[model samples]
Target: MTGVVGPGAVWLVLRATVLVVVAALLQVTVAADLEVLDGRPDLVVIAVASIAILQGPSAGAVAGFAGGFLVDSLGLGVIGSTSLTLVAVAYGVGVFGEGLRRTAAVRPLLAIGAASLAAGAGQLTLALLVGSVPQASPALALAIVPGAMLDVLLAIGLYPAVRLLLRRRGPRTVSLDLGAARV
Candidate 1:
C-alpha cells in the first residue's frame, strides 16, 4: 500500500482506513434501509471507487479487500461476497481511470455508475454459483439503474472529498525565470 503512492505511508493508510470504515458502517446501518427502485445505494462501492480513482488499481484492490472483509464480518451475508464484488468494483474503476482519469468530474461519476452495475452483477453471479440464488425478477434489472444513479450522486460528492483528504502535502514547486542569471 505504501509503495504505491511513495512517502506518507501512514497518512495514506489511515485516511483509507477511515474512509472504508465509515462507508461500511454507513452501508450497513444507513444505506441498507434506504431503497431506490428496489435497490439501495452502495456506499461501499462508492468509497472503493473514490479511492481507486485517487490511488490507482493496486490501492483500490487493497482497500476493497479490507472493506469487504469488514462488511462480511458484520454478518450481512455470505463470507467474501461483498469483498469479491468490491474488489471488482475497485479494479474496474481503477482501470477505467488509468486511461481517462484526467477528465476529472465526469470520470468518477461514470466510473462509479458503471461499477455499481458490475458490483450487483458480480454479487448475483457469485450467489448463483454458490447455490444461494437470490430472488430474480425484472425489478432486479431495473434496480441497477437507480442504484447506479444513487452511486453517481454519492460519488460526485465523495470522490472530491476523498481526493482532498488524501492529497499529497508538500512544498509547491516554483518555476523561476532564471534563464538570464549572471554567473
Candidate 2:
C-alpha cells in the first residue's frame, strides 16, 4: 500500500471533500427531479464509490460518511442512517478495488454498479430496522433495481472524469476488454 503524506495528503483530502459536497448538492438539486421508474439516481453514492475505488478503504469510508451525512442533513432523513450504509458500501468497494490490477479499465463501472445495489439494499435494510417503512413492499423493494441502473448509467459518463481528477503521476490509458482474448 502507498501512503500520501504532507501537503499532498492535505490536497487529496480537500479534493475529496469538494467532490463529495458537490455531489451531495447536485443530488439534492438537479438529480432529485430526474427520476426513472419512480427511482432517483444517487449522485452522492456514485461520488463516494468513485473516490473509494480510486483512493482506498480509509478514504472511501471517510468520503462515504461525509457524503451520506450531507444527504441526510439536506434531505431531513434519519441523521446517521445514510451515513452508516454509505460507510459500508464505500469501504467494501475500496477493498474490492485494492484486490484488482491497476490496469483494470472497467473496474470503475463494475464498482459503481455493485456499490449502487449494495447502497440500495443497505438503505432499505436500515429503513426497515428504523421502523421507517412498514414492510418491504414489492414496489419499494424493486425500486432499488432502477436506482442501481440509473447510477450505472450516470457513472458511465462521470467515472472517466473522476478518474481523470484523481489521476496521480501516470499516463492516462483506459481500455474496455470484454475478455475476448483467444489463447
Candidate 3:
C-alpha cells in the first residue's frame, strides 16, 4: 500500500497527522491561558482551515476532522463541537479558494476571521444544544476576541510557510515527447 501510494497523497497524510499532533500538543501546553486581550488564540483551527482552503475541499475536510478531533481531545470544550465547526469552515474556505487565491492578503484575514467566528459560534451552539447554558462570561468573551485576533495574526505569518511546505510535498508531473529523438 505504501509503495502504491502517490507521493502527494502520502505527504498529505503524513503532514496532516503531524499537524494534528503538534496542534494538540500546542493546545495542551503552550497555548494555555496565553491570552491576548482576554482571547485565547486558536492556532490549531486557524492553521487547519488556512491549509484546507489552500488545498481543496477534500483536503480541508480531512484536516478539519483531524484538527477538530485533536482540539476536542486536548481542550476542555465539548466533543464534536470543534469538529463540526472546523469541517464547515474548511469546506467554506476550500470553496472560496479561487477568489481567495486571487487576493493573497485577503486569504489569511478571511481564514482567521472565519475560523474564529465559527469556533466561537460552534462552542456557544454546542453549549446551548446540550442544555448546559454555562453562564456567558463577558470577561471570557473579551479574552477570546484577542486570542482569535492573535490566531489571525499567526495565520498571516504562517500562511507562506505552510504553502511552501505543501508545495514541497505535492506531487510532481513529468512530461515526455513521443516524437523526440531517442538517445
Candidate 4:
C-alpha cells in the first residue's frame, strides 16, 4: 500500500531470504554434516518453518522452495525434489496456523517439531518415489524424534528473530482465511 510493494512485505521477504540462505549455508557447511544424537538438525527446515509460522502459506512455500533448492544444490540431491518436500511442509504448517484463534509460546515449538518430522518424512518419501533407495533402517525411525527435537531447539531462537524482522506496525501477513493467531 505504501510502495510498489509494501515495505513490510519487502522486509519480510528479504529477511526470509537471508535466513534461508544463511541457514542453508550453515546446514551445508556445518549443521548437516555434524551428527548429534545420531541425527543432524535441519537448519533450513527450522528456518523456513520459523518464518512460515509468521509469514503464512504462500511466503512459507517460497521460503521452503529457496531453502530446499539450496540443499539440493549445495548437497548431493536431486533438484526440485527437496524443493517440493519443503514447500509442502511450509504450506501445511502455515495452513494449520491459519485456523487458530491464538497461539501460545509453545505454538512455535510444536510447529517446529511437526515441520521437522514432516520435512524428514517428505524428503524420504520423495526420494523413494524417485527411485532413490536411501538406506532405510530401524534407526531412521528413531532419528525422527531426535532430529525434530534438535530442530525445535534451533527454531526456538530462529523463530523469534524471524518474527521480529517480519514484524510491522499492523497486520502485514495475509492468512488464507483472514484469520491469525492472537499471539
Best by lDDT: 2
RMSD of each: 2.5, 7.9, 4.4, 7.9
Which lDDT tens digits does candidate 2 get at residues 48-159?
Answer: 9988888888889989999999999997788889999999999999999788765566777889889999999999999998898879988887889888988988898887
Residues 75-152, candidate 1: write the lDDT tens digits. Answer: 467778888988878987887777765448887788888888888788777877787866666766676778888888
Q: What is the Cα-based TM-score of model 3?
A: 0.78
Please estimate how well model 4 matches the true structure, expressed as its whole-model Cα lDDT.
0.78
Ranking by lDDT: 2, 1, 4, 3
lDDT of candidate model 3 versus the reference: 0.70
In candidate 3, the residue pairs with backbone N, CA or C atoms under 3 Å apart (3 or more residues apart, or in different chains) clash, namely: 38-143, 39-143, 39-144, 39-147
- Residue 12 lDDT (model 3): 65
Alpha carbon deviation, residue 53, candidate 3 (Å): 1.5
Best by TM-score: 1
Candidate 4 lDDT over residue span 1-183, tens digit each: 121155566665676688899988999899967878777899988888876777677788988998999999998779788899899999988877666433346787798899999988887777666778667766766668888988888777777777776666455675465466443
- Considering lDDT, which of the candidate structures 2 and 4 is the better prediction for this target? 2
Better of 3 and 4 by TM-score: 4
Q: Candidate 1 or 3, higher lDDT?
A: 1
> Stretches of candidate 4 above 4 Å error?
1-5, 100-103, 134-136, 169-183
Candidate 2, superposed: residue stretches over 4 Å from native: 169-183
Going through the candidates in the order shown, the clash numbers are 0, 0, 4, 0
